[model samples]
Target: MAEQKEDTQRERFKAFSHVFDEGTLRAIHKESSIGSFEALQSPIKIGKEANVFTAVKGDELRCVKVYRIAANFKKMYEYMASDPRYTGLKRNKMSIIYTWAIKEYRNLLRAREAGVKVPKPIHVFKNVLVMEFIGNKEPAPQLNNSSPSNPEKFCETLISNVRTLYQKAKLVHADLSAFNILNHNERPVIIDLSHAVDLRYPNANQMLERDIRIMCEYFKKMGVKKDYKEEVERIIAK
Candidate 1:
């Protein structure tokens, strides 16, 4: 029975391998062999640059965000080059994308240590990141897709998360907005940390302001009466 199951899993992996490059397929297989995840279950999200898939690790569900090597490499390079941490980063397309993935895993680890409500970082190999799945059975919907019943409370909690991320984590979520946030059981779970940067980054303040502006605009539509500029200042003010 175990041999039969192994053969079945290999067949499934072979089918899934078609979706990625040969190198990526080898990396996935390597991760699976090392017990990171058993198999790819289904795609949860198909973002512009990365594909988010649900995978199985033992009995638990895991999220795997795979950066597309064949996608818009120029855009990915532009974004990554500006970050201070990657100052001496190579101009190579695949290397930059891999660095971006590794950066996100590191950022999430920092956020988790800071008490932020982000998915737990499990493992990252090359351009693929394995993380704790946000929801049970199904991946949690983005905040924009599934608005919380209590907009005010939700917004407050989200801002609090931002505060924790800033004060405690000493990092800014540069791409924060309704789309990157998940509304799980009425609580906020931040996702998509690729754009997050440390406070020391040269463009950190500008990215922080943009993130605040986006959240403010989103909450304004949801009827949260507050000044965006003031909120941004409040979060950054020591």
Candidate 2:
């Protein structure tokens, strides 16, 4: 039984390695030992610096975001350096990528606890971050592609989520927009939190305004009347 289990794990690792690097394979194996997931099913997204995969844990589905070890991380290093939470982090490529994953995992946990609609983080090992998959059998589409049945309600819900993400999570996404928000059954699920920063970050206010501006620009095209200043106040209101 032990040999059989070992063989299965080896096969799983081998299959995963076809697309991932040795370091990423090692990271995923470490996470699997903690039961983060049984096997990686398939790649669901190919983002700028990371790839998202669907994994199975028993009968449940989970998301595994793996930062591309070879990705150009200079932008990330600069952005991450500004976040007070990541002060003193090494500026090396690998260190920056791993820290980005860690940041996303921590941000997701904080957002979830604060009642923002976000994927619940499951585990973090090296550059791999696992979280509860936010979708039905297949993953949800971005708001840009998945137009809601009721645009007004969708806009309202999105604003509420942003407000919660700010006032409760005490963080700014710094990159929030229709592109990063999944439209799951008309509800919004915010993703791509690696760039989020605590409000105490020196650029937090600017980041918040930028996020709101992006959202407003996207939603305005959808015919939602928006007052940028009013919306910003609404999100930060006491």
Candidate 3:
């Protein structure tokens, strides 16, 4: 039975091997060996840079994000190079990808410490990141797909999270939008923190303003009133 199970697992990995490189496969196997997850189930989201999948860890579910080796690393380096944390980073493609994964892990930890709602990071190795699954039976829908029942309250709570993320965490989510936020149990859960950067980044304020503007405009369509500039000021206020 154990041999059969191993064969099945190997086949499962083989199925997805076409999408990942040998190094990524080894990393995933390493994660499995460490009991991070038993097996990867199905892909949840496929973005330009990373692919997210649902994985089974013991009895509960977890999320596994794999950064694509063939992704636009040049664009990633361009974005990451500005962050103070990665100031002297080299131009190596694989290094940038690995660093990007590490950045997201750190960002999630910082945001959680700041009391912001996000997926709890489990572990990060190479280009693989395991995190808590934010959902009931299935994964939660994005804010754009599932509008909150109470738009005003939800908007307020989301803004508060953003404020805490900026003030307490001292980070700016460079790419914030309804598409990357999950509407979990009428609450907002921010995701895609790979682009979030330290406040010292040259374009942090600009990115923060853009984030607030996008969120405010999204909530406005749902009848939530908010001035983007005032919101930005409130977030940055001491």
Candidate 4:
């Protein structure tokens, strides 16, 4: 039975073989062996560097994020280079990618510990990360795709979470946007912490402003209006 199951996973994995290298395959198998999740299911989203999938773990569900080893990680290295936590990072492709995933895992945990709303990280391997699936049967739609019924409330929640993330967590989600925020049952759940940085990063303030600007622009389109500068002040108020 186990051999048959392995064969089945191999076939299924081959469907997306373009992204899975031998290292990725080994990481996925390790996750399964350690009971990270029962099995990786269909791909949920295939992005520039990673692909997301829904997996089963006993009676519950999980999300598996696999970062492509062959991805164009130049931007990733550039982004991570300035972060103090990753100082002196080697330029090796796989090393940079793995460290990128590790940084995301650490950021997720830090944000969670600081009471910021984010996916609950379950496990992390070299380039794979497992986290709580944020949806009912199907994964929740991005905030952009599934417009919230109460734009005002949704905006407030986003702002509040941003406040928590900045003030309590001292991390700026450099890539914050509607695309990375999920409107899960009308509440916002932040995702994609790979680009988040600590408060001490030199560009943290600029990144924060950019994040607020994006949110403000999105909300403005939704018939909500707010001064971006004032919102930033409010979020980082001491």
Candidate 5:
């Protein structure tokens, strides 16, 4: 039984190895050997730009997001160039994508420190990021896909998280929306922090307001009674 299990594990690892480039495979193997994860379980999401997978680490499960090297590098470059922190960055496509992954990891750490409900970042290498999984057996569904039973309370909680992220974390989630939020057991778990930026960024305030507006409009469409502009002002006031 032990030998059979070992063979099955080897076969699974071999299959996953084919999905990544040689360099990436080496990095993944290094991480696994160092105890980051035991094995790749399955893919959770395959977005146009990145692929998110679930991995096992001892008794725990984690999420691994891998950015595709052949993805839209031009768009990644454009986005990175706009961020004040990455200003004057080199024009290397792979470097830009790798930096983007690092940014997401750092942003999630900042958000977690601020008490915002987000996946805890585990490790990052090149264009791959590992984070705490949000669900038990399966990944959590996005808020857009799973509406909360209490829309009012849920919206309030989400707004509070946004405010905490901005005021305490000094970061703005430029792409905040229902699609990026995970409804984990009726609570909001924000994900996809790749576009989050520091408050010192030139357009940080504008981005914050836009995020608040998006959240308010989404809740309003779902029958929540609230003033979006007022909510934005209140959050910034703090």
Candidate 6:
């Protein structure tokens, strides 16, 4: 039965094999071999840098994110280079990509510890990460696709989450926006923490301002009245 299940999972993943180099494949297999997850079920989201898949883990589901080795490492390096945590990191492509995966795992851990609503990271192996799934039977829709029932209340929740992320976690989500937020049953759940940087990052304040502006602009369209500057002040207030 176990062998048959593995065969089925392999066939399912075969269609997306182009993104999985031999090294990444070995990393994924190691996760299963160690019982991190039972098997890959389906793709959650596929993109240029990373591919997220939903996998079975006991009675529940887990998300597996695989950072492609062929991704635009130059762009990743440029973004990662500014992060104080990765300062003086080797410019080697594989090392940068692997570090990107490790970075996200660490960021998620920090955010969770700070009481932020984010996917709970399970384990990170090389360029692959296993984390808690964020939805019910089907994945939640992105905030851009699913508007909230009460925009005012929802926006407040998100703002509070962002403030908590900054004040408690001391990290700025450099790439935050509606695109990376999941509207789960009218609540906001932030995702895509790979671009987040510690407060000590050179451009952390600018990134936090950008994050607030983008969120306020998006929420403004939904009838949530908020001044971006005021929100920024609110966030940065000691």
Off by over 4 Å in 6: 1-19
Off by over 4 Å in 3: 1-8
lDDT of residue 48 for candidate 5: 83
| Error of model 4, residue 205, in angstroms | 0.7
**Which stretches of model 4 miss by more than 4 angstroms?**
1-19
lDDT of 3 by residue, 79-195 (tens): 988887888898998999999999999999999999999999999999999999999979999998999999999999998999999999999988999988999999999999999
lDDT of each: 0.87, 0.88, 0.92, 0.90, 0.86, 0.90
For model 6, what is the error of residue 154's alpha carbon versus the real structure, in angstroms, after optimal superposition? 0.8
C-alpha-based local distance difference test score of model 3: 0.92
What tens digits encode model 6's per-residue C-alpha lDDT throughout 48-96? 8888999988799999999988889898899888887888889999999
Assess candidate 5 and give its lDDT: 0.86
lDDT tens per residue, model 1, 1-238: 9788777778877877768888888777777778889998998877778888999887899988888887786776787777777789888888888888899999999999999999999999998888999996988889989989999999989998998999999899988988899989999999988889888878887888899889988888989987888988889888
Candidate 3: the clashing residue pairs are none
lDDT of 1 at 137: 91
Model 2 agreement with the true structure over 62-179: per-residue lDDT tens digits: 9999989877789888888877888898978888888888999999999999999999999998899999998898999998889888777888888898889888999899888888
Q: Score residue 45 of candidate 4 by CA lDDT.
A: 96
Superposed Cα RMSD, model 2: 1.3
Clashes of 1: 0
User: On a 0 to 1 TM-score scale, where does candidate 1 land against the true structure?
Assistant: 0.94
Using lDDT as the yardstick, the better of models 2 and 4 is 4
**Cα-based TM-score, every candidate:** 0.94, 0.95, 0.96, 0.94, 0.92, 0.94
Clashing pairs in 1: none
Off by over 4 Å in 5: 1-10
Judging by TM-score, tell me the better candidate of 1 and 5: 1
Q: After aligning candidate 1 to the native by TM-score, how far in Å is the CA of 125 from where it should be? A: 0.5
TM-score of 4: 0.94
